[model samples]
Every structure is written in C-alpha cells, then in structure tokens.
Target: MPDSKLRLPPEAVKKQHSLVWRIILYFALSSITLSVIVGMVLATWNYHRQTEAFQSRLDYIEAGYTESLGSSLWFYDETQIHTQVKGIMNLEDISYVRVTDNLNLDIETGTRPHHQDIKTIELVYKNKPLGNLQVAFDRQAVLTEASQTAIMMIIAQLASLLLLTSLLVFVVHRLITSRIRDMALEVNERIDSNSSEALSIPESAVHDEIDILIHAFNTLSEKMNNELKQKTRAQQQLKQVNSELEDRVEERTQSLQTTIDELNHALKALNKTQGKLIEAEKLSALGGMVAGISHEINTPLGLCITIHSYIDDHYQQLKSGFDSGQITKQDFSDFVAIMDESLGIMDKNLQRAAHLIKSFKQVSEDQTGEHIRDFSVKDYLNEILETLSPKFKKTRHQVHIDCSEHMRMSTYPGAISQVMTNLLMNSLIHGFENKEQGNINILIAEEKGNAVIRYSDDGKGLNEEAKQKIFDPFYTTKRGQGGTGLGMHLVYNIVNQRLQGDITIEKDCGCEGACFRLIIPKKLDVSDS
Candidate 1:
C-alpha cells in the first residue's frame, strides 16, 4: 500500500499517540476490530447453519418429488413431472428444479438463480439408477440476513466497548492523573512561595507509589530547610563579626590618627622653641661683645685724657713765659718746640681714641642693625675681628683675615657681619674647644659677581656627621655645656637667606680644619628677603 502509515505527519502521529488520547483510541480501535472479527465469525456460522437446514429440507422434498415424478416418467406422463418440479420451485430459495428419465428426456421448472448455485441429485428406483435432478438456491436472502446479523453484533459489541473504555479512562484519571496533578500543583506552590513550611499531600487510608514519592520529597525538603536555616544563622553571625571588626578597626585608626596629630603639634612647638633659642644665643653673644668693646674703649679714653692733661700744662707754662718777657729766644723756641711736641702727642692720642671708637661703633652697628651699604671687604673684616677680640684674648688662638682690600660689595652689611661673627665664635668655642692655640683664617674674594668667603680654623675639625648637621638648628656637640647650637645655623641662614647665596663645607679645600665656603651676591636682591 504505498507506505500510507509513514506518510502521516509527525505532529499528527504524536497527537495520535498521546497518552490519554492513545489510550482511548487504542481501546476504541481494539474493541471495534475485535467486534468486527467476532461478528464476522458468528454471522458466517449462523448463515452456514441456516443454509444447511434449508438444503436438508430441500433434499427431502426433492427425494419425494423425484419418486413421484420418476413413476410418472416411467408411464411417460409429462404432466406429473411438471407438477412435482413446479411444487419444488415454489419453495423458498429454490430458484430452479429439474428432473430427467432413463431415455434422456428432461423436464424443468423455474430459471436457476445462478449456474454456480445449483445443487444436483440422482434418483434411483429399487436400487437401480432412474434419472437425475438439479436445483439452485437463491443466495441473496441469506447474505442479507447474515449482513444484518453482523451489523447488529458489531453495534452491540462497540457500545459495550465504548462504555467499558469510558469507565476505565475515568477510573485511571481519578486514581492516578488527578493525584499527579495535585502533587505537581503542590510542588509548584512550594517553589513559588519559598516558604519554610513543608509540602503536604492529603493521604488516604490506602497508600500508593505517589505517597512514597511525596514522603521522599518531604524528607528532602526538611533537610534543605534545615540547611537553609543553618546558613542563615551563620550569615548573621558573620555579619555581626564583620561589624565588630569594622568598629575595632575604625577605633584603632582613630587612635593612631590622634597620636599622629599630637606628635605633629609637639613637633611644631619644638621647632618654634628652637628658633627662639637661636635668637637668644645671638643676643647673648652680642652682650658679650658689648662688654668687651666697653673694656677696649676705656684704654683709648685713658690715653687721650692723659695726653690732654700734659698738653694743657705745657700750654699754660709757655703762655706764662711768653707774656712776662722773661723768656730768652732759646727758651721761647724750646717752649714752642715743647708746645708743638705736646700738641703732636695730644693729636696722636685723640686720633687713636677716635679710630678705636669708630671701629667699635661700625662693628656694633653692623652686628645690631640691618642695612645694605658699600664696605671694603678687608676693612670690614678687620673691624669684625677687632670687635671679637675679647673671645680670642683669653686664649692663644689668633684670627687672620685675607682679602682684596679694594674689593667692596654693595650688600647687607649687618647680615654679613653677623654671619662672620657667628662663624668666628663657632670656631672659637667648638673648633678650638680644648686647644691652647688655634689659627682662624677668613679669606674673602670676588667671584662671578658674588663675594666668596672661605673661613677655616687650624683646630680640631668636625667629623662627617658634624659637618653634615653643622647647619641644622639645635644640633649641638656640646649640649649640656650651654652650647645653644645656633651659631653655625645662624651663619647659614644669614648667608643663604639674607645674602641670597649658598654656603658649603668645602671638604676638598686641603685644610686640616673644617673649611666653610660662603658665596654671597655682591648686590643682594633685598626683595627676596
């Protein structure tokens, strides 16, 4: 048949084979097919039995008619043969009947329904063959009856099958499908709700496989819920621990920050104190200078007074001699000579005093004040050494100045003086601390539009550490011995900041003492200050 089953669409086949529909279809098809097969068997058997009974009746009738007709045929009576054959034909389903004699003479009545449906018999008289008879049965009535019986049987069987199938489907739906749907719904509800509550399926007194499935799911759900609860508890504990840790960390950070701020505040205060201490030390040095210069000026003033006294006395005596005319020419000349000599002595003493006063005044003014002025490098350095004489006076240490006398700079005189003074004092105190004699050298020159000074002392030089921190404030080698540590630091500040230049410890200067080189602009940019 052209693979008709395979020609069906896949979707159609799937629908045909669906569980519920397939069940119903299978039940219907099997019932109908079985009903058809059984109906056919029963109908065939009934038709065959009825047809045999009719054939038996026809055979008895045919025998009696054949006997009576055979006697007539022996008498050669055609009327009697025709009458008996006609009687057999009038019977139901007898389409045709025929009789024949020994002489081959035949008599017939009615047309045969079909040649293939004919039945034939031989008539015998006294055990001798007399003639033959043939008859055909009408098959349409038997076929009609058999067809009706088969249809009725098929209808009855189909109705009963349909009822039985419906009952089975209903029972299966009730027993299995409904329970499965309810369980599925419950599972969906449990998932959607995500509740801690366990799933519940109503159970009958008689339990089945679904109950076992529900029990397994319930056990699993309980385990999951228990685990979920444990996880929640652990998370809450972890969150609490994290909160505690964060608080502790914040507290620690705050403590560290407070300590840092306090340290910074203390550091600022210490720096301010250091600056004040440096200034105090500078003033203390100035006070000592003042005392020394006072002692120095006293000597010159004493010489001037003594010289004035002598000159006044000589002038009075000479005036007296000249006015009274008792003086000889030689006496007058001697008086004039003596007076001139006295005047010379007085003038010399006064000049000496003036020079001392001038030097002291200029040095003091430069140290105590700030002003830019033109000054000879050699002369100004001599004045500074002179003012600082008292420091070296007690010891055998001597300071030497070497510079171009003609080299003058237009710069901060006071700042320069202070820088030189601090350097000198630092050498006297620190460089020559325990020495009996030391030589201090201050060399000045002009280089690249700047005044360069190389100050060194032939005393115990500084070590590498001291040389590095020598310019740092409050970094003293003599901390407990009233060493303020500001001398070199002040020198550095004055040279670098006020003079707009730089200073360095010249390690390669080939000196046994610490050689400090200062370069100051000849004309300072005061605006930078």
Candidate 2:
C-alpha cells in the first residue's frame, strides 16, 4: 500500500533555461537562409551570361569564314578551294577553316579530317556560280575549348560564392556573434566579480544589420542605467525613512517596557502582601484543625488505656491465685484470653493516634514552617532534588545541577527542600504538560559570604501576566487540576521568613521562548556596599 503521509509534490529548485537559447538559434538560422538564396541567384545569372557570349563568338567566326570563301575562286572546282583555305586556317578562335567542292570528291580538302569544322558556301565569279567551299571545324578541339570555358565559368562562380560567403559569415559572425559573445563575456565577468560597468561595442565596424542592432542595444542600456540611477535615489529615500521609523519603533518599545516593568513591580508587591495574608489565614485554619484532630484522637486513646489498666489488674490477681494453686486451669486460660483482647484493643487505638499525630505534624510544619539546619547547600539541594525523583520520572523531566565544587555554605535543609519541591512540581505540572521533553536546572554558589541557589526549567514558562501573580498565595492556575495554590507561597515563606533570604525571578528574553531565573543570596538580607 502507498503511504498516505508520503510527500507527493516537487521541492523548489532552479528552473531549466529556455528563452535565450531560442533567440540565438532563430537569429543564426534566418541569416544562413537569406545568405544561401541570394548566393544561388547570382551564380545562376553568371553561368547564363558566360554561356551566351561563347555561343555568339562561335556564330561570328562562322560568318567570317563564309564571306572570305565567296570573295574569289581560282577555279570552279572544289579541289583548289580546299587547298587554298587550309593554308590560311591556323588561327586561335577559328579552330579550323575548310572549303570543299561538290564536284571533285578526291584530294578536295586541306587535310579535311584534321581541320574539324566546315562552312559550306557557293564560290561565284561574275554571276557565274562555282563549286561550293566547305570548311570543317574540329569537333574535338571545339568541345575541349567549350569544356575549358565551362570549367573557368564554374570556377569563377565558385570563387565569387566563396568570397561572398566568407564575407557574409565573417560579418555576421564577427559583427554580430563575436561582438555579442564578447559583450556577454564582459557582462558575465563583471557580474561574477560584482562590477557594474557598461559594455562598449567595438568601432571600425560599418553599418551592417548587426551595427544597427548594437546601436539599439546600447541605447537601451543607457536608458536602463538612467532608470537605475533614479531607482537608487528612491531607494536611498526609502532607507532614510526606514531608519527614522526604526528609531521611533525603538522609542515606543522602551516606553512599553517601562510601563510593563512598573506593572510587574506593583503586582509583585500586591502578591507578596496577598500571599502573607492568605498564608496566615491558611495557617490559622490548619492550627485550629490540628488542635481539634489531636483532641479527637486523644479521647478514644485515653478510654482504651483506662480499660487496659483495669483488665491488667484483674489478670494479675488471677495469675497470682493460679501460681499459688488457689485457682483452676480453666480459670487461668480465661484470664489469659481476656488480657489478649484488652491488649489488641489498646494496640489498634494507639496506632490510630500515632497516624493522626504524624499527619498533624507534617501539615503544621509546612504551614507554619520547618526547623532551620546548618548544612552544605549542595548536599541539601541534592537531597531535595532526589526526593523529587518521583515527580521528575512521572513527567519525564531532565535536571541539570551546576554547583561550585568544594564550596559549602550553611542553610536550612527543610526550607530548601520545600522550595525546590514546589518549583519542580510547578514546572512538571504546568510547563511540561504537552511537551516532548523538559529540563530543570539547579545551580548553587556562594557570593560574599552568602549562599545562593538557582533553579530553572526549559519547559514552558509563565507568561507576562502570569509571571507576576504565579507566586501569590491561593491564586492558582491549576484550580480544577488539584492545585492547592499554597505551593509557591509555602516555598516563599520557607525561603524568606523561615530561612531569612530574598528571592528573584528572571523572565523571557524574547528569543525562542521564556527563561526563568531564581536569584537568591547565600545568606538572606545581605547587601554589597
């Protein structure tokens, strides 16, 4: 089965390049296509003009041969004419000139087969027509000249094409591609090193298509620079305004802080007085209840003692009689049974009395106070913390103890124990309720003959409002959750009144969350002069 909680979306990454590459490709393709078409048309026209001129040359040579042959004739026989024409036929453009007679078929030519072309014309004298002059042009020679001319024409065409192509490619590549590449490289290098300089196009370049384009690009760049300067001006103004705004914000913050501090101090004084009043009230109530409970337990206890004493006297009398052989074995057993019943009643009542006394003593001590003891603060604090092991384990709380090694001071163990226990319980119950983990820190030291103990936690701490009143007696946030509201008050009483020390709490620094500080003197009411 596919996991329902698996992520099915793409994470953010750089996008692939598409736009700029297409532009470069389109520009190069268009240039090449335009160049090829123009080149082909010019080459075709050159080929046609060269071919027509060669054909005209051939026609002029043929006409000159006919007129010269018709000028005169030694005889009206073909044999003499052929002999005369062959003697004067050794020229370049006229490959061969031949006159052949229609009458004599023998020895009628000037090496007839050798001189290939023949212009046939009638030899006439004074209105008398002679035999025809037939001249032959060499088929092999004419075709060879035509082939060379064709080759030269093709070479000329190719040369022109090569020159034009090279020029176009270089102009487009250098005037366009190379220049652009240089500009791009310059821009890229500047950007890499964080330099802000405009790219300048090279001069000595004429007005080609790319030259016009470069001019446009340069104009745009200048316009952009101007706009950028305007933007920079606006940005500076915004920065100044922001700085002023920040100063105002800071002033307001300090004012708010002062107001908050005063409220905290007032609330603290109120809570201290309130705690004292409430603690006195709870103490009075507890004292009265303790007295009543003691009285109630003593009545039943006294009755059991009276009943046991009376029964003991009877048993003693019976035992004395039995030992003297003045009583029966049945009488002895009955007396022993009665004594056992009396002892049982007495033992049960005594146990009940002992329980009442222990509960009363514990409540009285916590409400009133505990005896002070001179002991090492480190040892005392450790004992209290260990006694809080149950609370720590239950709430999965972590504790850190940082104390000066080999430093010892005199303090009350019971007071510290009660104070530490109260704070730890408060943190575990309220601070780490829904948290994954929690921390409690215990620090001990001596400063100028005064012992100091500090305890804190990484759990959720008191809010701004709650921090002020959290130490107040009977002012509990855990009302429905079995909070007695007397825990911190009791702790305060134990620390300040009983132990003769002062306490201070540190609040949040506005970082990740709240931080609590507990600063206490190694000794109470000590001031540095």
Highest lDDT against the true fold, candidate: 1
Segments of candidate 2 deviating more than 4 angstroms: 1-369, 508-516, 519-529
Per-residue lDDT of model 1, residues 278-350, tens digit only: 7787788778888887777777678768767876786687778779976677876776787687778777767
Q: Estimate each model's TM-score.
A: 0.49, 0.30
RMSD in angstroms, all models?
A: 35.0, 27.1
Residues 1-529 of candidate 2: C-alpha lDDT, one tens digit per residue: 1223432222211111122335445654665555455555555555555445545644654465444545434344454445456554554333444444345533343345543234555655565564565545445554555555655655665566567655655555544555555555565566577655556765444677656666676676678778889999999999999999999999999999999999999999987887687666455445545556656577668979797787978878897997788998788788878878888888888886776666455444543554443455555455554334434545566878888657664444445555665676677777777886877777676676766666667766777667787667677877887666776767676566766676666654443323444445554432320
Cand. 2 TM to true fold: 0.30
List the candidate 1 regions with Cα displacement exceeding 4 Å. 1-238, 245-272, 308-343, 393-395
Each candidate's number of clashing pairs is 0, 20
Predicted structure with the largest TM-score when compared to the true one: 1
Model 1 alpha-carbon miss at residue 324, Å:
11
Error of 1 at 482 (Å): 2.8
